[model samples]
Target: MASIVPAEKIDVIRRIEQLAVGAGLAAIVQTAIKLGIPDSFDDGSVTVDELAKSAQAEPGTLGRLMRALTVHGVFDEVEPGRYTHNDLSRYLREDAPIPIKYLVLWMGAAWTWEAWPRLTDAIRTGKAVIPDIYGKDFYSYLGAEGAAGMGDFMKAMTAITALSAAPIVDGFDLTGVGSVADIAGGQGRLLVELMERFPHVSGTLFDLETVVANADPKLLPGGALADRTTIVHGDLYDKVPVDVDLYILKNILDAPNQQSDRALLNIKESAKPGAKVVIIDALMDASVEELRVTTLVDLFLLLNVGGARHNTKEFEILFEKAGLKFLGIKPVPGTFPTQHLAEALVP
Candidate 1:
């Protein structure tokens, strides 16, 4: 193990410089995706001229950008003027699972990226930079962006859930659990998958009315558990639906002090005695470096959303604060895990 002594200024400065370079590269990729170039490239290999033409970009200018991304392995310069999509770029394609194309574009949008420049403001005032950036709370700002942008938000969250939901689905045992409620679960994608895989287990997806309306009904095909699949239109802050074991909160709970407090309280009230409450979220550990780019991800939540990554101890305290006790915390293996599955029981 190595210690980051402040007196070791060279190491610290190198790390800071790396972060800046990475952020710049991210900005370029973000701009390209938002312009729909990646989605256009999925048809097959194409030269920069072809890519730019189809993407409606200036051919000469796009040539330089493709060279830049190619140097970094996003695209491969197959020959002097031919280029092909690489592994990293493939995820930006339309059919890719958890297509990060929109997610990256959303996160790197001017509103979000602008907030990082004022990271100090959030740290000093203990206020979220989201309101500072968007002139409203993050969730409210989603509405202010108009229906199209709200649709983007829903799609972006669905993509995120597809990636983050694996930990809970893989680590937990659902042996006797017949029904589950996904609290603040938008669109019910996870619930649909749960019901499909474990036929014995049914699910109720509780989310906002707008969210339910926007959800693709294909996810809720009417059938055996389709009758069992339920959608409760309400806010998790107000009330969570009752009388179901195995409540899961997938990537929820980033807010001001009181907001987080109220959310936990609501979950506690919704649960019966001894019901399992599963929390799936990013959990920092001493070995965060073991996972690729995970440390930067911690800061991403903090600078963007005023949310800092927490360790098991922080989560345990959160559970105890809301009258719940920790059952266990487990690391999901064989995947790029951005979260830890922490299960607790309401006392």
Candidate 2:
């Protein structure tokens, strides 16, 4: 007979088991969102039959999926065979205020899902495998696939940027800054939020012409910013709005170190003396959780884009090399998502 496992080893075994089925768990959640199963519960408690009917799924199979998600707190079975929205499940609602449906969709998308298995190849080659695996770079594929898929990906990214923007706007001080440039500010979400917060601060929304062209309706919803915000279109490596007091490069450094250096140098050269270059990203650290998310994102950049996350030391080196002085780093508070604000100055 097999030897009985020790109690200490039991937790480890359980952890391993959990990790083993993690993908299936993620798939369950994704399916629930995709099927609009959570939408059925919005009115109140819903039977599996109702959820299945609404989602056009068979009752028995849908019930199994719901049961698996319930075990992981994605939904609550209030009564036998009936489900209701729990805290987690509510966010998957089709019209959730903080819509994560897109995130679920993107994460579970075929291309992204397929790339994970090639992680070892990426590490070995020190190059992105997405192009090799998918026959195109990620963005090119997204573009070629047409707007629907790209829109979903952009929506997911916008949701993530929205979550991070609040803590940043509240945490960082932006007083007396005459003008600001949000480099690669997609859809103008963060810049709009910041502009709303500081009415006196005129802003320039600098990004690709294509990106800015599609940014109407989502680029701050009022005339208040009409006079204050200018949507300037250009590549960051080539040019940014010069002489801006503050230039925000939120989550833009996820490139190969050399490319990041060139981009930083471009910004530094354009920036007037003593201007601030604020970089917002998850700076790598010693904490396990920090390492987990940041390193995975770093790997993601490596696999798809050619970018990587920077530790403080790495940022220090990048800043020094780019003709900018490291000003220090600040942590954005609130548990939604923690990212470090690395401030540097053009010398």
Candidate 3:
């Protein structure tokens, strides 16, 4: 056995302590989001006293949190004690692009806070702590909360997707694809962007009835493809548009169980025999460090909607099940290895 050096031991101890400190800081941000601190600050800068009054926290306590958060680059300490939205905190604003405020509150304060504390139970049992924490699966909880909860969850997902959007646009080619259909495309954002970029490509944004109901034409700016874009309300488990030459499914099947095959089969059945089907979802290779994040995503899907991330083999099975032939599995640059752009042909 190798003897432990005193200095090395001290270093390890310090790193463990730092991890605890990071967890504490995250807790503070959680509390702030739960207390509506971000929303309050969204309008403009406010003094600690004003924030305290709004949050119903004592002046002294609130000031301390604000200072710590400012140091962390979340909020800005604009004039010593006064505070304003920094880039990090502004992202928590409800109307801000991706609007992760409720998501922060939900995960940080709600599910994660409870789930993490009982991680030992999960470890021992090798079972999800979601039912134990929330008394139900995550999706059931959200479905019970109705549209408001769904909107928050989707916003959080969109926030995550937004981070990798630029890389996606760059990695995938849309130059010559004439008719594109975005299956289970929420709110039509990605398809709209793709259509706007490739003026020659007409598109359809397909989503659930409720989701398509909320889509607005104004979201797609360029008039060149305006007439070409249609919002189609349909169930991916049922059928996909037949005439579309290009089919894109982004982060759709990761949410539900066995629906990946269902969605793909539908797309394959209706698609032109040689139509391109692009599947963009979390794909984990056997060797990768960000595999932890991918693993967590699997749990998130299981706990939330009985869905999960697929390995390369699992994806191949789906392709076979769907009567689609694999064309390629490529990685988008500047993203995690688990994020794969799997292109298949509807055969």
* Best candidate according to lDDT: 2
Candidate 3 per-residue lDDT over residues 324-343, each given as its tens digit: 88887877777533467888
Candidate 3 colliding pairs = none
Ranking by TM-score: 2, 1, 3
lDDT of each: 0.73, 0.79, 0.73
Model 3 local distance difference test score: 0.73
RMSD of each: 4.7, 2.3, 4.7
Which of the predicted structures, 2 or 3, would earn the higher lDDT when compared with the native?
A: 2
The sequence of per-residue lDDT tens digits that candidate 1 reaches over residues 1-347 is: 55565656877788888776977788778767766777776646788778777878898888888877888778788886678778888888778877767677666666666777787887797667777666787767766776666776677777877775555477768977887988888877777667777778868888777787765574456545567777777877787766688888867754443656677788788778878888777666746464355555555666655666667888787788887888888776643555667888888
Off by over 4 Å in 2: 2-8, 216-224
lDDT of 2 by residue, 135-203 (tens): 887666776767676777778877888887777888667776888888877777788888888877888
- TM-score for candidate 3: 0.76
Off by over 4 Å in 1: 1-18, 42-44, 164-167, 216-225, 290-292, 303-305
Model 1 residue 241 distance off true place after TM-score fit, in angstroms:
3.2
Which of the numbered candidates is closest to the native, going by highest TM-score? 2
lDDT of 1 at 1: 50
